[model samples]
Target: MLAGKYSTLGAMPTERTFAMIKPDGVRRGLTAEILRRIELKGYRTVGLKLYQIPRETAESHYGEHSAKPFFGELVDFITSGPVVAIALEGENAIAGWRSMMGATNPANAAPGTIRGDFATSVGENVTHGSDSPESAQRELALFFAEGELLK
Candidate 1:
């Protein structure tokens, strides 16, 4: 399937999940490996693209974290290089991607995960996944224009 818009169960796929490879992932050439894992998990990629996030977009995307000390660093890191953003469809995909991504800090992440396999620091965790369904929808809207990623 191109972008997995649903699962076999036909539960209507609660909500879409959004994921993005950080600058480090692109610089290290881990994009294929990361996408492979997502495909292997049986989820469908509804949308995929390689683009550099503008500073404004990055700021809005991480706006909730603006008050945090690392917010500026987060924005800068995300905009530092090209990133691959994906829209995934499947049951519980938001949570699933988060699990697949492991912990926020690679040091705490379990082995056999994308972060565990490639990341070395919390700031460069390699990928970003939607924390909730609402955010997933919001983020999908932010990164993908209408019809940009098909189901």
Candidate 2:
């Protein structure tokens, strides 16, 4: 379910997207800067945690990429260190967070975006954002359990 905000009139529905500061980003101490950008853009952080991802969880999370040649590398990188998983709520959060994350390949990302500024390579790209609403819901469920999210 989408996260909702209460207004004077009634409940105003808002989108919830999943975002992660990859091991590289966290190791580089970019977590605060990245989170600041999200909050500065007016997204609410409903849930957050820094934890080492288990192999099974990572496999499920990246299940769609199972057939790809780089799948094992992707899983290995993600589980290499602690990552910060966050649940963000806002209007058009899925797209919004993606925009903030910049291009998947840091070489191609623009100067002002997170990846552009922090990442040096595609394999070590510093963040992850849900590409669509459906993915957001599934991702959020994967990282957070019931009652973990704030109202």
Candidate 3:
């Protein structure tokens, strides 16, 4: 199990978020650093796995971006390499993960953030994070099943 900083109780019941270390991040050998940050931020890694998603799965995962011109490219990029999928748990985990991820475009991310620290290009941004509670729930469901993420 991954180490985490957290309290037993809080304003929000223990929440969950889905996070991914994208291909570029893994290729750059930043997985441990990224996981360290997540742990240091108080989110427990309830579930973790390294897997290469098939093209169809990648397409379905990013289906919200299907209308965008970069949809095909996005799918290709994601399916081209193995990714680290994580289910994080803690109070406000969804929001916490997003703040840690910074902006979608590394150039727009603030200094000291994960993207700002390691990413150079928007398309090769190092990570993926759930944008909202609804998104977190939906994404978690897609990546993890019941009993997959433990307390």
Candidate 4:
């Protein structure tokens, strides 16, 4: 019955993606729910950790937005509280995670999405998912070292 879930090529190639339950999500006690959703979608958690992000690491993680006006606020918020870093592996992991996250702005997200259901604003959205495979590799490296990821 579940045979059509993927494609004729059999299961899609497994890929890893990076995700972070942001400060607001942690402060609001939504970590379990978020991770549960990921697991329920059939992805495997290869790596996980709870830690306060250092300023230097935060800056590097968000380097692409360094020139943006909200860059300071972005870094400040992420570094403000403890966050849960997650590395999830599965087929189409990057896009799947992003779809689960919904729109960047909660106001614009659909009703069933994580952001649509829990987030209040763009600045304090519940979670972060890498937008592409390249970003995933980069972000996973930032949050998790080679040894941290399960083979």
Which candidate has the top score in TM-score?
4
- lDDT (Cα atoms) of all candidates against the true structure: 0.90, 0.93, 0.88, 0.94
TM-score of 2: 0.91
- Model 1: per-residue Cα lDDT over 56-98, one tens digit each: 9999999999999989999999999999999998778988999
Off by over 4 Å in 1: 1-14
The prediction achieving the highest lDDT against the true structure is 4
State the displacement of the C-alpha of residue 30, model 4, in Å, after optimal TM-score superposition: 0.1
Among all windows of 10 consecutive residues in model 1, the one with the lowest summed lDDT is: 2-11
* Cα-based lDDT at residue 134, candidate 1: 86
lDDT for model 4 comes to 0.94
For model 2, the local distance difference test gives 0.93
Greater-TM-score candidate between 3 and 4: 4
lDDT of 4 at 96: 90
> Backbone clashes in each candidate structure, one number apiece?
4, 0, 0, 0
Alpha-carbon TM-score of each model against the true structure: 0.90, 0.91, 0.89, 0.93
- Candidate 1 scores a C-alpha RMSD against the true structure in Å of 5.0
